[model samples]
Target chain A: MKRIFKIYTPFINAGMQETATYRVNWVFYILGSVLGCFVSYFIWHAVFLSGSGETMNGFSLPQMIVYIFLIFLTSTMIGSDAAWAVGEEVRDGSIAMRLIKPVSYNATFLFQELGNKLLTEMFLVVPLIAGLEIVRTVIVGRVEFSVVNLLIYLCSCVLAYLINFFFNICFGFLAFVIKYLWGANMMKNCIVGFLSGAIIPLSFLPETLGRIFMLLPFASLNYTPVMIYMGVYQGTELLYYIGLQVFWALFFFGLSKLLWVVSVRRLSVQGG
Target chain B: MKHIRRLFRIHRIFVVQELKRMMEYKGDFIVGVIGFLMVQCSNLLFLWIIFNNIPNLLGWSLNEVVFIYGFSLIPKGIDHLFFDNLWAIGHFTVRKGDFDKYLTRPVNTLVHVLFEKLQIDALGELIMGIALVCVSLPQLQIEWSVFKVLLGIAAVFFATFIFTGIKIITASVAFWKKRSGNIIYMVYMFNDFAKYPVTIYNEVIKNLITYIIPFAFTAYFPALYLLTGENPLYNVGMTVLMSLALMSLGVFVWHRGIRAYESAGS
Candidate 1:
């Protein structure tokens, strides 16, 4: 166990070094975020214009803009289609070398991915976010964010990453059984987009669907946290959301471990 | 005449081969069709929600909006069906060095790349589009004048040219840099914005869409004619001419870009 930890710590440290560098594929990251944020600004701006109401569902224009901004920002920051990456690696025989290492392949990936994500968020997402905030203030003409709410939002964003990672790993590990995991990843993307309220806000959903959405683990990654930040929920609701996130993180993480073990066994049987 | 026939034969063969390739996974083809329909249904639901809130958007009625969506979908569907490969052409050609094979071909490399794949599932979107048009025509309460019907056909064809033109231009960007995927995404973003009435957007963005990007011609101008039961502006002739001209310009730009291509791998 100690040997495994030692091997992975250095592997993750190397990954962290690569992650800390702001050179490779960073342009695509910025371009995607900029395009997403810019296009969304135009879309919601038009939607909001169709009414004379002061707000849509208790969110003022600025608040709504913030919601959209954070939704895109956090989705880009927190979202990891790990299954897609892992499935590709396994299918291409890269997993062979990974499995031979002293540490568990999944453990190494978990730490490396977290490190890469942290690097991306700090170097790219954070600066872009700061610029977006400035732009939003200029365009919407006001800015209001509570420090406590911001902190909570940030923590939930991190938890969202864990949930996403676990789901990805579970689906990714299926590559051991299925030769092609593109379809599975596609389905995962579709489900997560809808369930997590990343497509459209849960607040925008019908009351019954919104209630159902709240019950789903996917909501903890996005909708619940954003709403809480927007002051849509108070103490008990906030606590419930955070607690639900904890439950989901643990549940999915455990499931990923089980899936990993089964997948490894299947791979060994196949001489893979 | 003989040359034209030979070209047509090659096009047909290309399409047939693409169809055969797609047939390898018949289950996927079916699921893909269903998935596309679900996506279209979601877009239609957004329209329904909008109409439920208000009877019409801007001055256009529900049927007019539906007509816009319908016509837009036709070009979009055909774009995906025939030129679906355009989205990936940049990446495949430049990054992966797939352009070497195209350069070796006797035919126009651009045409070869553009028509390499036909996403058969987009046929579902096209059928839905035609259905929406038929449904919308009756609800719009318009006379079936000969000129109006002809204009509608022209509009749909014009839309195809414009959309294919944009895809070609965006794909041609791969000649310069490998990161042209975002360029394609930017085009799609504008295409999404163009689905609704132009009047819904603010003045500056509206102008940009119309004059600079020419996305307005894809659905907005055509839908306006259908909605008003007359040409919305005296510039119908000008708009049609402009659409064709822009398409030609796109082709010209693609020709220019292709000449500068440095095939990455081979």
Candidate 2:
């Protein structure tokens, strides 16, 4: 047990170091996220206007605005392009060093990815969210905040992050089979973009599609948490959604572990 | 004249090689194309949902928006298929030190870099875009004139030029900043806004899009010319002229940006 801790400590320390190094780039990310949110804001504002005076699918103009702002924040917070890591390392012959590490590469990758992601969200996404509120006040008036709702939203966001991390790691493991994993990852992005209700609200979706999507892991990433925050799903249903996120996270993490086991074995034997 | 002819020939050869390479992984290629088409289909699907709920959005009917979506793809798809390498320019040239090799080459660096890889996978998006225009034709209420048809095609090309130019400019920013690839993220954040009709936006925004960014010409202005019988600025000719001017301006900016290039990793 002490031996394991000794190995893991250095890996965790390295992740902390990388976070510190990349911390300066967080400003660009904040600006980019803010710009992205502004685009979504314009799109939703136009959409709401066309829906006549009536609020389509129970989303008031304010609710729609808030939902889109959160969607931008959540995707920026959780989304990772880690799928390309394995392919690049393998092709470039850097996987050898990873294999020789005292700690498990998968564990290092997971912990490091989480550390980097947390820093990105804190420094970048938080500022953008704050900026959005400031811009909103100037453009459309004041925003109402609820402490209870914020706590629930944060919980859902954590669950969503784990789900995103698991699925993206699964995509990375595909490098064992495919030479270039970009196409596979791009396909994943498209699915997440559409089904997650990031681009369009799930409430605006047809009843059947909305219900089906809400059950999926993709929805947990951006849609469900944002929806819950905007009060789209209430009470018991919100709890159910959060529970499903937990189930999906555990399920995907397990699958990823299995895939990692097979992939590493293949890598070792095939001399990847 | 002879050198120009030779350059064109080399470009054709490069494109053919790329096509052959794409053909090697026929199954993966097909899957990729299908997946891209599905994503494009979802864009249409979103429009369908909106039209079903509200019937029209800021004077754009389901068919008109469909037409705009379809034609907009022409420029975007062409850029993707022909100039996909340009999208990676910032990373490849600056961060990866790949630009060092490009500068050493005798021929024009821009031409070679722009055509390095062709995403034939985007052919799916291109076909869908054309099919969309065809599908909307019968459903479309407005009469199609020969002049309008010419203008439409011109506008699509112009939009492609603008899109490619934007990518080039942003990608070139890698010269000054590490991981300038983030600029693509920023561009995507803004570019997707062009998908909707600009009429829905307030005057300030509409003017910003029209004059500053020229995103309005990409789909909105040309789309308005198609949908409404009367053009905002008289005839389609004027709109086409403006689009050409924007495309030229984009090319000019790209050229200026290229000249400002300082290779990474001194």
Candidate 3:
């Protein structure tokens, strides 16, 4: 284990260094997120103000604002473009370089992604969320924060990242067959964006559709963690949500492993 | 006149070459078209869901909002089809020093770079836009006239100029920054605001979109005029003016950027 750790440490460090070099890009990325948050916030605010209701779709005005903010935060925390990167490597056959290396490709990719996400969460997401929390507190008063909930939320976030990573890897493997994965990537983004409640709250969806989406792995990515943070699920239900997240993460990881094996074998047979 | 004709001939040849290259990967083209169609479909679904919950957003009905959304796509699609290569400037050409090739070309560098590639994927957006407009036409109940048709064509033409102008200006930042893809992306993303009625937003956002970014000229104002047949002269006039101003500004920036260009070493 120590030897394996030593092997991956360089990759993690290199990943962090590479991300730091793109400071301007990161600034614009955060700006885009802030702008997106504002768009959603203002849309919801307009809807609530114009409509004759204290609550629409089971959320009060303040709750809705906080919910949108949390949605953006959760999305930033869990989202991964590893699939696109992996897909590009696979398409160009540079993935062969990694294959010849002593380290496992999956582990290397995971560590690199971890390095990138850690820096982003530290420098971009954390500060943004902190500022947003202050704004939320000012507008909506204190949020209910408990040590227990925080712990569970953190666990769920980890599981959510794993699920997102594996889910993306599955799509990345499509590069084995498709000459261009841009369309597939966009399709995956649209489906996942909708199903994961990144675009709208799951509660706002129809009952049948919402329940179906809950059963899918995408929900575990964003909705589950946000719901836990909001204290919407507690006790046995909370445990169930966490269990589901774990299950999806493991499920996707196994599936991605299988797909990767098959794809590598196909590539080899094709003289790739 | 001779120079203009030569430019058109060169543009046509470049477009043909681009089309040939795109056709070489027919499966990729099909997938790209389907992918974009799915994106538009999902957006429509979101709008449908919103309208289902609330019959109207602000004072605009579902059809009106959809009309505006659909109308916005035409100019965007046209710009994408013709000038999408501007994205390569911010993304790679300048950053990787490939921009040196454009400088070596004898023809106008901006035109040469722009006409170098045609994005066929935008055909999806164009088709979808036309489909949406047709679907909403009867519901809008606008009186059809030759003058109205001409006006609509003019509005879309000017809107295309606006989209191209913004892209060129944003991409020109590559001269100084090495890579300005993120800034370009952020600016393009702001166009999402133009898909809906400006009244849905607060005063500050409204002003920002209207005067600062002038995205309101791209879709909302023109759609409002077409649907209500009110303020046709003012709205369309402003769109034309904005388009010309933005295009000139884009040219000015391109000239400035070219002067500042220090080619990345091979």
Best candidate, DockQ: 3
Docking class of 3: medium
Point out where model 1 deviates above 4 Å.
A1-52, A127-143, A173-187, A265-272, B54-56, B232-239
Q: Between candidates 1 and 3, name the one with more favorable TM-score.
A: 3
Candidate 3 chain A weakest ten by summed lDDT: A142-151
- Name the docking class for model 2: acceptable
- What value does the lDDT take at residue B219 in candidate 1? 80
**Model 1 over residues B123-145: C-alpha lDDT tens digits?**
77888888888898876766667
Which numbered prediction scores highest in lDDT against the true structure? Answer: 3
lDDT of 2 by residue, A1-272 (tens): 88776667666677667878755445555665676566656655766777776477887776677777788778877776556776677657788888876676667776677667665667665665576567656656666655577678888888887888778778887777876566666677888899899768887887998889888888888988887776667889878888899999998889888887888777743354
Against the native complex, each candidate's DockQ, computed on alpha carbons, is: 0.25, 0.41, 0.58
Residue A33 Cα positional deviation in candidate 2, in Å, after optimal superposition? 5.3
Candidate 2 lDDT by residue in tens digits, B15-91 = 89987987788777877788778788877777777677775776567787788778777777888888888657654
Candidate 1, CAPRI quality class derived from DockQ: acceptable
Model 2 residue B32 CA deviation (Å) reads 2.9
- Chain A of candidate 2 compared with the true chain A, TM-score: 0.86
Which of candidates 2 and 3 is the stronger one according to TM-score? 3
